[model samples]
Target: MSQPVAPKKLRVRGMILTGGVAAITIVGTRRSNITQKKEVIQDAHYEVDMISTLETRRAGLMQARQQWERKAKALQERIDGNKLRTIPGIGGTNGATDGSASSGK
Candidate 1:
């Protein structure tokens, strides 16, 4: 009878230890999943922010490109005007082949 009682007690203690181990494993897995989910959410937010920043920079570059194009066009117009002024007989009806007034005709 003494031997049988000792075996029963040992079985119960073993079952309790097994149950504790199972519970700890489950809790650890849950915490790891939660941490992984949080990391995924943070990564999603960072991606959106990065995309928005890139889009803003692209828009600014496009605006700067348009402004430079306009400046280039203005400069080209000034250069063309200077070219026309340098051409002889293109300024007026004056017979001066050079950029001076004619004495006779």
Candidate 2:
């Protein structure tokens, strides 16, 4: 009976080297992908934090605007009241300019 043929050593070594290179390439690609994913996650977190901060600032600005408007309204009303008092026929002033009563001749 014929003997079984044996595999060549040089061919086996080449195949092993090719396989090692392929494995290294795959591992390197996966590592780069993982790094990119980590950066994306960090960016997303940063955006969320920034949005929250901006919203808080906006709310504060809105509240301040409302307070300012209320104060302005009150000031305008006071000015209008003073104007009415200064007018001749509004009944706001007694019309005694020098603390003396005028008599009609």
Candidate 3:
């Protein structure tokens, strides 16, 4: 009887194929990580811009509020001055300034 033919050894080819696949996987993973980092940076910049815009709007509103308060105070002072002018001896210490004291029974 003839000797059994030996089985072919495929170890070297299998190792090369595995190494190629591993290199591709490693490169793909690195690229994906870089993409994720870029997206995070962009999102952070967008949030900063939104906060800056809000601060600018808040400053404008505060200035408007202060201006309105000043106008309201000026108007109140004018009204108080007019009331003082219309009333005679209001807040005076003398008792005769009051009408009831001046009129004899």
Please give each candidate's TM-score: 0.77, 0.73, 0.67
lDDT of 3 by residue, 25-103 (tens): 9999999999999999999999999999999999999999999999999999999998868455655655446566655
Per-model clash counts, in order, read 0, 0, 0
TM-score of candidate 2 to 2 decimals: 0.73
What is each predicted model's overall lDDT from 0 to 1? 0.91, 0.85, 0.84
Per-residue lDDT of 1-105 in model 2, one digit per residue for the tens?
A: 233323466677889999999999999999999999999999999999999999999999999999999999999999999876755443434665555656657
Ordering by TM-score: 1, 2, 3
The lDDT, on a scale of 0 to 1, for candidate 1 is: 0.91
Model 1 is weakest, by summed lDDT over 10 consecutive residues, at: 90-99
Off by over 4 Å in 3: 1-9, 87-105
Candidate closest to the true structure, highest TM-score: 1
State the TM-score for model 1.
0.77
Residues 1-105 of candidate 1 have per-residue lDDT tens digits of: 699999999999999999999999999999999999999999999999999999999999999999999999999999999876766565466646665764665
Any runs in candidate 1 off by more than 4 Å, and if so which? 87-105
- Superposed model 2: Cα runs more than 4 Å off: 1-7, 87-105
Error of 2 at 78 (Å): 1.1
